[model samples]
Target chain A: MQCPSDKSKSAMLAYVLKQYGIVIALILICTALSFCSPHFLTWPNLITVTRQISLNGILAVGVTFVLLTGGVDLSLGSLVALTGVVAASFAHPGDYPLIIPVMAGILAGMACGAANGVVITRGRVAPFIVTLGMMTIARGLALVISGGKPVSNMSPSMTRLGGDFLGLPIPVLVLCGISAVSWLFLKNVRLGRYIYAVGGNENAARAAGINVNGVKLLAYTICGAMAGLAGVILAARITTGQPNAGLAYELDAIAAAVIGGTSLSGGIGGVGGTLLGALLMGVINNGLDLLNVSSYYQQIVKGIIIVGAVWLDRKHGK
Target chain B: MIIRSSKHFIGMFLLLLSALIYSGCNRDAAPDKKTATDGSRQLVVGVSLMNLSSEFIVLINKAMLESAKDMGIKLIITDAQRSAEKQVQQIETFIGQKVDAIILNPCEVEASSPAVDTAIAAGIPIINVNSATKSTPTAFVGSSDEESGRIAMEYIVKRLSGTGNILIMQGYMGQAAQIKRDQGADEVLAKNAGIKVLARQTAEWDRAKAMSLMENWIQTFGSKVNAVYAHNDEMAMGALIALENAKLKDKIVVVGVDAIADAVQAVKAGRLDATVFQDAAGQGRTAVKLAVKIAKKEPFEKETFIPFQLVTKENVDKFAR
Candidate 1:
């Protein structure tokens, strides 16, 4: 017994809630944390939180592409270690120009990604199995290359990339730049639209004469390149290429993507939502630490929030 | 056409079979190759480590290798990758090979104990190095984790004149080092009531984790943090880096366990205040020597405890390289 106009109004409200629920939740959490901990809303603490999440953010953004194309990259954490070591080897003082190390890291990542793409497309293997294999292969390569020790003594100029630029942290700025370009690419580019089409329906995309394999390949390669960039930034931040660095980092990145409403199955998310998801996680961690909460409790709270966020997303989508 | 293709496939298969056999024979000849060069069957000692990826364990492995080379012993080294099950399997493989002696760097006290029993049953002398196994081995060579904890805390207490707010960056929870180090630190804390521990958290003995944890603490505690005691040099170095980033390194006293190369360098550079030296080389050397003696049917001590040393700026030069 509702009027047609009233039904449309409620439908509009539902749409807004579906799209911006995470944003509202993030705001509420931030407000609550600001009240609970005096240190939570300060400028320095905010910068620190952003800096902490930058590595995972870059990774999450990259993986979003693969996820959109109905694929997942389990090799992110290992690739981070491998590329970090490769970049650090060239990052020694007076060894190479800054750009050389950066390029080496990114190229290493891109090659691994391209390899993954080739195997998945041409070799006709599942993304999960291929990436799982790549995970171990990359880790082994990292250990062998670095001889099971942290590669340290990076040049000061390279290390400074981990520091502040103008007033903001360099890593956070990098994340912003990457997020903007990627967001635009996903929205307006023909290849970007094709990524969505392939993920949305593989048979339909093929019927429409789209190159499904090529799009999927590009998604994974982009994912790998992001991982490489993240690795270099991490090495610069820690001032070493630690063989054990980025352990379980992929899990965190995936969680951020999933929490942001990106479907594990494919074709349902964007950078805006992913950044909000990463921001929520960062704020929660910073809030817990500021409140002096025990790490054991912090872990439990984080797990619950991840599950809860995904649950809400599912409920709203349906 | 079908007959010719089948014949070609058969020839390729035969070539692959011969190649595999040749490689197998080469592997079988490795032990004898050493014997042929040595002019005698050299004493073969099998060494299994917890994890080689860790810097500390690698140091122990390096020292053992050096000592084995100097003593003309053939050491068969295997990495368990921190798996107790794998460590036991390696020990069994050594037994199958009829090794003269066995050296074990255990991954856990209880989980790695079966390795010792299996070696004992096979009538091979086994020495536990760097860590303990619940099942008694022939001999043990390790520095006391509790003593290391006590030494690090004592140095911090001295630096602070017995009164200050401190934080402790722990290793992985429930680890032997973590528990004993905590006990040792608590013992010192119980004696000095004026020194208050503001917070203690686990960083898993990882540099990156410790760095993040320290950064958070800086945000929460601000200038109230007076000192930090990390369970390992990696965590210590991490805390130092975080403190340096915040420009608070000068006001804080940072100490850690294990005088790793980086930690020693930090101490010399007047960054890290102090780090306890666990003597990886000494432990490794002694374990290998004792293992050889037991294999040769010579008397050996059942327990060998290497004392830990403290490395500060003054004494860091001695410990460095």
Candidate 2:
């Protein structure tokens, strides 16, 4: 084993650098931007950006898990809306018992994930196509359930997730906790190794006696669960379960994952890098507002940055 | 073999427990109400809305329903979700249900013409609210986007001393609101050469995108940018966040249309300079009134323009929750 150790060490170093290159670049960009703009480094602005990115970050954690297993989950966005609406239905004033809605939301997301998993595994459908169909169906169900309305008048207990603690949002803390758990799972758990093995080569994993289908199913279910949790936080933040909430959020999650150096090809990436990518995006958005830039050109710039990131990744392949 | 048998048993028990839990939860939840009495002389007014995602539009829908109840009319509302085709289907359904009148917030000014024509051919009176379709209806009731834009521009000019580089955040292109608002802003720009229009782009009424776009604009123009004009409160809120992040909150003036609760709060907090209040609730109520009057064969104006107010910190407290 020691004979080829030197070459492997260099290769591992290269892989690690490739995985975190975008994050390092983003930090550099933020540092330079902060120097250019006096307001960029302020405590209030940093808190605002962190609060804004928390929900997306939490959702991205689950999405990263699925992506690591070489699977895509488009239904995550719709699941968020569905969970939010369902959870809000359980909300009542002075209801200190928040378990009902939280559990309901989690169950709803898990059920949706199970459905996606069953459809893909049992029906022998591609994950992309299956999840895409699930996306439309789930969104329609959300509208049908909510009657094209915003579910408002939520309980204060439910609203506490969006409130501040020591000048930081509770949701941000939740995001950090979720990220920590994801880190531990991906780095140390047997299931995490199985996910990487399955993603790296499904046939090889099956040959090695690993349950490939089961691993993929678990990945999607976890993604769904995380999306549901994100939905609850979103509903609390907005104080409403908007039928149209989380529309196009899948794109943002995918973008964050890709920017964080998660290979679309799978078996690569981690929650830490995804968090950094999401923060980069949040900072850019917040900094732009502070600078008073027009919204139209902002989109073009964001698209260019996304494209540029992928190009950079390809150039420095892991 | 014994260990395998125990694992199977545990799995089966968990499955059974999950099923039981699901059923129990389902039973406890209230059943959806779907029954409605038929054959009454109740006036059914069909409302086809463009979108219900925003708080402003949601407030308008609630107000419309409340006004309809007061006017002794039954409301049948459908959200188009920003799809013209879906709105057309909803209108067809309304016609099938024999609705007495139709109130439409057209997704597109031109694409809604066919549906408006169908409603007209069916002898059902149609009223346009918040926005108008290309095909004229019996009554059009909503704020003048052009006027609102002009008011927003005037405020920006006064704050910037008639000279500054302003960014214009446009809405969905080809839509009535976008067209009129841009026209109004252009008219103001033509008058004041001193006030430069640095850049103009469409945010499509998304806050996150608006914030990102504003950030790039900052990188491009640096400190030359003086103010931002968003088409809606959401975009304005996004722009304000961007400005705050850049430490330009107090120096730059930000204006947006639709005095939504968030925008109102922003104004009160001195984060946003001004926004045009279109009176969404009033618009909804007036549209219902016009629909009822038309159903009753009473005379009403063909085009009813609602008043718009430029709400600033001084007046935002009255509008804020």
Candidate 3:
């Protein structure tokens, strides 16, 4: 009995290693890259990486929640663009108080998200198709509202959200805060358990008295709201609301989630892993920049890294 | 379960609270029509921009607005966000408002013809700026795309000694800029047998996308790539970032157009070889001036071609803002 127990312990260890193998590999890659480039380990470079990660980190957090409920939010990126433009309109200097623009921006994002939720839940359409349609529509709306122009002169307080906080960007802080709260929610909240249940087996979750539709709506809403927040932060950072802002951000968010060990099939990941994935991407981009890699080659390397992570995940059955 | 319910309730409450706050805020912040400059009897001018989100367009618009203000012209601005449909609607709105003159930076040359016609039918003299439309306007003010492309190619050929593998990162497919630039690059490539065009792809004017495309090209071509020519500075900047990452910063020469702020800085830092300066602001000022000229029956050139300068490290400081 004791010998069998030891074998089981080793098996559990192997399983855990397999599940987190990509993260370990990512660490190893960072170490190797750091050794190769002296600037890779610097404080400023690290902070830049953190700042870059915040965009995807925030999006991935929302994506993780959706993935937990076996759904996807393709409109998050477009929502960001739309919200950025809308918020920028409100951010006209001396037009209104700071809170007005900020609240309006947040509301715009929520409304967009709510619309997405309604289409997916009430309309009973597939989340993928619904979001894909939304992506175009929202982007079009963004362009329309801004009159094909970039909205500038955003409120100073809004811009402050993108400013530095204790040597780090406010966006990075927000990302960290979001990550911590999401982790806690996933681990300690019953809705979190329901999300996992729904992803693991929707029919089972339904039978267990979980309102799966409500969970999905919540997930998508969160995704939209977070994307909205990201847009606001991005607008603040760039000091302009660009209709073209957050273009192709969805790919980055999805890639980060997958690389961080979120199974595409859903129900197997958390914000912690997504955070790691986002960090990995950010570090790689910063390192590449530091090493003077051409932008074209950087993209190729990013694709490879994403594929490698996925391959490793499959190989380890995680 | 209780904790979950309470959290859900809190979330719902926050959502409702935010919604109420938003409505209230919007109500308080409505733009006052009465405060708007009264131009009821003035020759109203409508400015339809392709997109204002980019620095290039923003600068152009600012210049135009300044010119309009100086001339005491009443101008109404509308943004198309790069949508032909939206641009059409904006033109219709201008027509409805009975503007005396219209300035357009068409999103698509052909797609904007109907809208241009609509304005023309309404007797509004149109001045197309930065980009030309298929329909003739009172005057068109923009740099010659073909010439700029030739200049860019000339710079690259001079730098690479006309013998090397080069990659061409195209802009949006079927756009006037892409067509002209490609034509110019092709003319040069056809003549220089030693210079090989390794790969061509569209960066779509996106820095990140351009960076990724350039990265892939580098990975495929490695040190064999002698130079890169992007349609615009943003894409070039993206390529520069990739080259910097791969430790190939000084190995390959990179050229771009638009000579944007960042691109100019890159050239100053010796990271980029050259960029073509479009003087977008000048074009804006010129467009507004021409619109007012046509509105007032003043003679203006049928077509005005703005001169573009090839900016390099030697001449970059002169162009710096």
Top-TM-score structure, candidate number: 1
Q: Which pairs clash inside model 2?
A: A288-B215, A289-B242, A289-B243, A290-B242, A290-B243, A290-B246, A298-B213
Docking class of 2: incorrect
2 against 3, candidate with superior lDDT = 2
What is the per-residue lDDT of model 1 for residues A30-122, given as tens digits with 9 covering 90 to 100?
999989988888889988899889999999999999998889999999999999999999999999999999999999999999999999998
Ranking according to lDDT, highest score first:
1, 2, 3
lDDT string, candidate 3, A1-318, tens digits: 001125677666665665577677678778988897765666655665677688789999888888777788888888888888877888877788777766777788778777888888887889899989999899889977876666665666776776677777788899989888888888889887777878888998899899988888878887888888888777776556778877879988988887887767767788877888888787776666556565467679988887887778667753
Q: What is the lDDT of residue B130 in candidate 3?
A: 88
* Candidate 3: Cα lDDT at A297: 75
Model 1 per-residue lDDT tens digits across residues B224-258: 98899999989999999889989999999999998
TM-score of each: 0.94, 0.72, 0.62
Q: Please report, in order, the local distance difference test score of every candidate based on alpha carbons.
A: 0.89, 0.80, 0.79
Q: Candidate 2 at B117: error in angstroms?
A: 2.6
Please estimate how well model 1 matches the true structure, expressed as its whole-model Cα lDDT. 0.89
Cα lDDT for residue A8, candidate 1 = 76
| Chain A only TM-scores, each candidate in turn | 0.95, 0.94, 0.93
Q: Name model 3 segments beyond 4 Å from true.
A: A1-62, A70-75, A78-191, A198-243, A251-318, B1-41
- lDDT for B195 in candidate 1 is 93
Q: Kindly report which residue stretches of model 1 are placed more than 4 angstroms away from their true locations once superposed.
A: A1-15, B1-40
TM-score of predicted structure 1, chain A: 0.95
lDDT of 3 at A87: 77
